[model samples]
Target chain A: MEQIGLSHIAITTGILLILTGLWGILTQKNIIKMIIGFSLFDTGIHIVMVGVGYVEGKTAPILDEAVQLKEAARQIVDPLPQAMVLTAIVIGIGITALMLAYALRLYQKNKTLDIQKFNDLKW
Target chain B: MIIKIIAIIIGLAILLMALIAVYNKKLIVAIVAAGVVSLFASVMYLLLSAPDVAMTEAAIGSGLSTIIFFYVVNKIRKNRKDHA
Candidate 1:
């Protein structure tokens, strides 16, 4: 019961982070604010993924003195999520850089940060 | 037990900072607050037993991203001043 409760705490926090990021993305009008929101959203998803992979009272997946190869399957937390998150974090940085470049270009063209002002694509 | 409580507090701080980053009228304040949010989230990742993620978040999310933002903002301001 205690183990489950503790794990739930992590998961709940991840969910809350996700909600906060979503709110930022939805409400903010500035392009830079929107980029910040996107980064938060990416971080939130990574947290949730890592939180879900955590097993109560388990060590990291590294095989060492504390955690042996024989008991690794049972004793180590899931490594797949951690691996995926590693890739995701790098990819998130790349995507954010791209978004910021776009924001810079937009600002250069329009001389404003307001998203509503970028109406060239709007029909 | 205590770690879990600390994690929760950090999570709440991240949320509050995210809100401030998004809703603040001043762009510079919002950008700085957003970087703080990423920094705290990296700490939360550590508490969640994701040291690699924490490092990456700190380096890329908090460090590089904020620097890039400030650089772009500076360029934009310079361009505006030149235009004016």
Candidate 2:
């Protein structure tokens, strides 16, 4: 009971984070604010991924003295999600940077940050 | 037991800060609050036993992203001042 509760708490937190980020993205008017919201969403997803991969009594996936070779397969927590998250984090940074660059260029072109004002594509 | 409590507390803090970041009237305040959310999230990552993810979140999400945001804000402010 206790063990299940721990992971449950973490997973719930992740869901809350995602909801907050989504709310920000939907309601905010500024481009930069939307970017910040996107980052938050990315972080929330990563947290959930890590939370889902967690094991109750297992250690990290590092092979060492405490986690011997033969028992490692059973004793170690899942490593695949962690590896994917690392890549995702870096990609998140790149995407944020790219979005910021777009914001800068848009500001230079239109001299405004309000999303409604830049509706050239709107029909 | 204690660890669970701590995680819950931190998670609540993250949610609160995120709300502040999204709804604050001041853009700078919103940006800073977002940075705080990222910092707390890195701590949550640590609790989840992904030291590598924690480190990445701390460095990229909290630190570099905030710096980039501030830089862009400053640039826009300076441009507006010059034009005004």
Candidate 3:
């Protein structure tokens, strides 16, 4: 693994985001906060994947004869993460929407957003 | 080096926002802080060169979620007042 500089930074940030998410989940009393924590955790992992694909001193994948397109392609950032992130993005949206719908239903039934006040599901 | 510094700042911002969301007395402030953290995370995603993830984070993570939470909060508040 050729790790240095920016890559190290990316890795550290990813770890930090995960830690923050964990803290949020553990400490927050509200359902919405938990959702936010989950999202943040998801985003952090996605960022780490993107960072893993980074190529030092590489331009984005764009074809142009004016520049050294072939050379650039040789050192180009990984396209797999780009593609994967697209999939993740859509999945995140779907999940968030579904979670919000559930939250709404929970609120409607309980009349409270506080998770502590919600004990009907706890059996 | 600069990018790493930026990433560290973004991470700190995320931590700060998460704290605010967890500890803020006002529900609205917490909600807004969550939105800000999502927005900051999206910016970090862009910095890490994930534009697609950044866009989705901005839209779904910050936008739709915040609005939904606000609506839910408003409903809860109104219902409580109705009982009082």
Give the number of the best model, judged by DockQ: 2
**Model 2: per-residue lDDT, tens digit, B26-69?**
88999999899989988987887778888998999889989999
What residue runs in model 1 are displaced by over 4 Å at the alpha carbon? Answer: A1-4
Report the candidate with higher lDDT, 2 versus 3: 2
Q: A9-121 in candidate 3: lDDT tens per residue?
A: 67667777777778877888888778777766776777677778877656444456634855766755667887897688678767866887798788778766788897767
Over the full model, what C-alpha lDDT does candidate 3 score relative to the true structure?
Answer: 0.75
Model 3 misplaced stretches (Cα beyond 4 Å)? A1-4, A64-67, A121-123
- Candidate 3 residue-wise lDDT, B1-84, digit = tens: 677678778878887887777678787898898788879878876776666667887888789878877886787778779977
Q: What's model 3's lDDT at A74?
A: 77
User: Candidate 1 at residue A104, lDDT?
Assistant: 88
Show the colliding residue pairs in model 2.
none
Per-prediction DockQ comes to: 0.67, 0.76, 0.52
**Positional deviation of A39 in candidate 1, in angstroms?**
0.8
lDDT of each: 0.82, 0.87, 0.75
What's candidate 2's DockQ score? 0.76
Question: What are the per-residue Cα lDDT tens digits for candidate 1 across A2-116?
Answer: 5544457667767877787788888888888888888878878888898898887687777879887787899877888888998998998889889889988888888898988
True contacts kept of each: 0.62, 0.69, 0.47
